[model samples]
Target: DQQVKQNSPSLSVQEGRISILNCDYTNSMFDYFLWYKKYPAEGPTFLISISSIKDKNEDGRFTVFLNKSAKHLSLHIVPSQPGDSAVYFCAARGYTGKLIFGQGTTLQVKP
Candidate 1:
C-alpha cells in the first residue's frame, strides 16, 4: 500500500518566489518526515526534515511543516531558484530507519 501521496505531479514557480510542495500520509506510525530532491539520473539528495513532535522546522531557504491531525506535511522553498528545479519526494520514517516515499513532484523554477 502507498503510505504517502503527493497529489500534485508537478509544481511551477518563478525565481525569487515561494514554492510549496505538499504531501499526505495514511499511516500514523511515522514519527519523522523528510524531503529529498533528485536530479535526472541521480540519487536523491536530502533536503530538510521535521519531527512529529514539532509543528515546523526551518533551515535556510527551506521549511517543513507537519500536521499530525491531518496526517499531512509540506515543504516550502522561499525565493526559489532555477537550481532548485528537480523532482522532490516526501518521505516518512517509522521507528526504524526505513522510509516510505510519495510519488515525486517535479518542480520547475522559471528564471
Candidate 2:
C-alpha cells in the first residue's frame, strides 16, 4: 500500500502570512519526495524535493522537511501571496517514474 495522504483538502491564509501543508505516507520504501504546485489548468510544477537521506530542503520561499522515521513530510511557504494560491501535491517517486501522489491541497490566499 503505497498511499500518500494529504489529510486536508484545502487551506486558506491571509497574504503576507505563513502557509503550511502536511502530508503522511504509509510506505517506508519511498525514498525520493517532491512537492509540486499546480495552477488551475496546467500541470504541476516541481517546487522542492528532498531525498530520504536528507531531513530538509528549501528553495526560495518554499521549504520541505521530511521525518523519515515517522514517514511524514511538510511544505512551508512564508509570506504567502496570492500567486501562491494553488493546488499542492505531495509525491514520491517509485520504480518507473511513477509517482504516488496525495489527493492534493488547495491553498487560498486572501488579499
Least accurate 10 contiguous residues by lDDT in model 2 = 91-100
* lDDT per residue (tens digit) for residues 1-111 in model 1: 899999999999999999999999998889899999999999999999999999999999999999899999999999899999999999999987789999999999999
Give candidate 1's error at residue 92 in angstroms: 0.4
Candidate 2, 4-104: lDDT as tens digits: 99999999999999999999998877879999999987988989999989999888889999998899999999989999999999998765666899999
lDDT of model 1 at position 8: 99
State which candidate has the highest lDDT: 1
lDDT on C-alpha atoms for all candidate structures: 0.96, 0.92
Candidate 1 has a TM-score of 0.97
Using all chains and alpha carbons, the TM-scores for the candidates as numbered come to 0.97, 0.94
The number of the candidate with the highest TM-score is 1
Clashing pairs in 1: none
